[model samples]
Target: MAAQLREILLRTRRHLLLARPGEQPSRLAGEGLDFRELREYTLDDDIRHLNWKSMARIRKPLVNRYNESRQISVGLVYLNSGSLAIGAPVSKKDLAVELLTALSYAAARSGERVSTWFLGADECAYYPPGRRQGDLAERNHALATALEAKGEPADSEQLLRELGPRLRRRSVLFLLGDFMKPLDLSALASRHEIHALILRDRLDEELPGGSFLLEDTGSLRRKEAVIDPAAREHYRRLVREQDAALFEHFRRHGIGWEKFGTSQEPIARLAQYLRRP
Candidate 1:
């Protein structure tokens, strides 16, 4: 039953990922293949895909066998930098894990490769892509562990430096966080096409309209802020500025970006972004 739902989700995702028949390959924010493999050259095959090594071994030219070009490989970075350890209905960290998993699974089932990276403040935890059921279980367990752990602080600029050595093929990357600070994103902005999912709970976006002690559940730290006009405006401006900066960065680098709220609209909003050309 769950497998059926996964298929349904994958098909839905594929439908959202529209591509012209045999036109520009789906490598960007679209459903595309995971890897490009080389197979034995066949008649009517494109000579451009010929592998030189297979030529020596089989005494015949080998051709490229791309994993259906209409799939997109996705890499999700579940950021829990102590900042996202806030809010209700669903914890920010848990929400990030769920959404990232949904996105990854959708891509993976659509004949794409999906990976998860847990950026634990200074370092990263990687779950390499695999089709095996056990591998998927390991990925889920790793993500849950990350959701429980705390991130020291994140420097988005320095992240790609560590990530560059790992990823060989181009893949879509998502950085999910509450993004309350000005993160230097120049490095990652260039290396991979990054999409930032700015996560915010009901309190942050909708505003609860009451004075309550803002507390971090993970750390039990508390701060008192008057939920009045001044505080509201202050927060609104700050969020807008950060959002604008992120948007501008993506635009400048030609990186496709989307922001997901912690409310029920996340999947819908993300689905809309995925539907865009």
Candidate 2:
């Protein structure tokens, strides 16, 4: 386990080193006083940064961009729900850990203060913001330990309510979860730059025809069912609808997101997402 963690850390470091100087892990605009540039306003741009004078003169909405602070605050939220434990050969939970580790490591290496929160239905753990290498290691160890324990249903409402207040400073928050339930992150998005890392297994969308016994990880309830062609099609349609609604929600609220499968390497996918303009 330690060796694997080391490998992930090394890989993330290498990726960062090879990345172009202008490519940043998070958005560039922040609370810094130095003016970077003025650009046309986009949906993702914070309304608070809108330059009213410029808009009045140009007859177009524009936002002032400020250089990001030397040490930005980064928040990592791991939704340790039992649903994540359900995956194929590689569980969604394992993939989530890898993504979380890479993000935390990258943030710390870039001189950003990293704060981590591990949240389950009935429990929560937090590691305060720190830039030290030892602090990053401790956060990673705690995250691994939490994932190994039994998982419960995710209380996302409670998470939003509790976590929002704890993060006093404006931050770039990354939420890692299966997100099998409905989500409304409008309030949180308004205050912080939010990104959702959605983890899933291939089986989630495609189920083979067979009689099988399935257990609800959240409730630990067992049920027997047969998957016919019709049933499979119905399930797939529902998944598609769910994903469409999820993406729409992200778009409406101006939140960034990416979907990761258990079979894929998370670090590469994450790097690609971070490099987006």
Candidate 3:
């Protein structure tokens, strides 16, 4: 496990190194006191920084840019639900950990403070923001250990209640999960910049056509089910509806999201998402 994590970190570092200048994965712009330049307003720009006077003069929506700060805070939340343990060849939990490690390493390498929270149904393990080398190493180890352990069902309410109050600063938050549950993140989105990395498996969307026994990973309960053509179609439709609703909610709340299959490499995909202006 240790060697595997080391390899992932090594690959992540190499990937970051290969990225061209100005395309680094860090997207958290600083809000410093020093004024920078004025640029056209983007959807991602904070409305508080909108230059009303400049907009009235130029007749174009513009926002004030501030000099980037030396350091910024990054919060990573891992939704450790049992369903993440389901995947062929490799589990979603493993993929999530890989992505989490990459993001944490990148942030720490850029001299930004990183905080991590592994939240489950009954437990929550939080590591406060730290920029030191030792702190990053410790966080990676803990993240690996948590992913290997059995996960409980996800409790969205508990997650919001616990994580919301602790994040006093307006930071960049990355939410790693399958997100199969109904979620309302308006409060968090309003306070911070949120990016969601949705991890999923092919099997989640399409089930094989046959009769088989199914088990709920969260409850460890078994049931017999027949997956005929009709059943498969129904399941597919439900999944589509669920995803549509999820994406719509994200759009309405101004949350940036990207979906990654468990079979694919997340480092490159994550970098691409972060490169968005």
Candidate 1 lDDT, 192-240, residue by residue in tens: 6777777777665545556788866446589986688877777777777
What would the TM-scores of all predictions be? 0.67, 0.82, 0.83
Global fold similarity of model 1 (TM-score)? 0.67
Count: clashes, candidate 2 = 0
Q: How far in Å is the alpha carbon of 126 misplaced in model 2?
A: 1.2
Compared with the true structure, all predictions reach lDDT values of: 0.62, 0.78, 0.79
True-vs-predicted CA distance for residue 78, candidate 1, Å: 1.2
Error at 264, model 1, angstroms: 1.7
Q: Write model 2 residue lDDT over 1-277, tens digit each, in one string.
A: 7787888778777665344433455452234478899999887665667899999998999988877655678898888777787776789888887878888777776777888888888878888888786468556755664665345745658877769778898889999888777778888898888999999898878888999998878777999999999999999999899989989999999999999998887788888888676
Candidate 2 vs 3: which has more TM-score:
3
In model 2, which residue pairs have backbone atoms overlapping below 3 Å? none
lDDT tens digits, residues 230-253, model 3? 999999999999999999989998
lDDT of 1: 0.62
Winning candidate number (TM-score): 3
Sorted by TM-score (best first), the order is 3, 2, 1
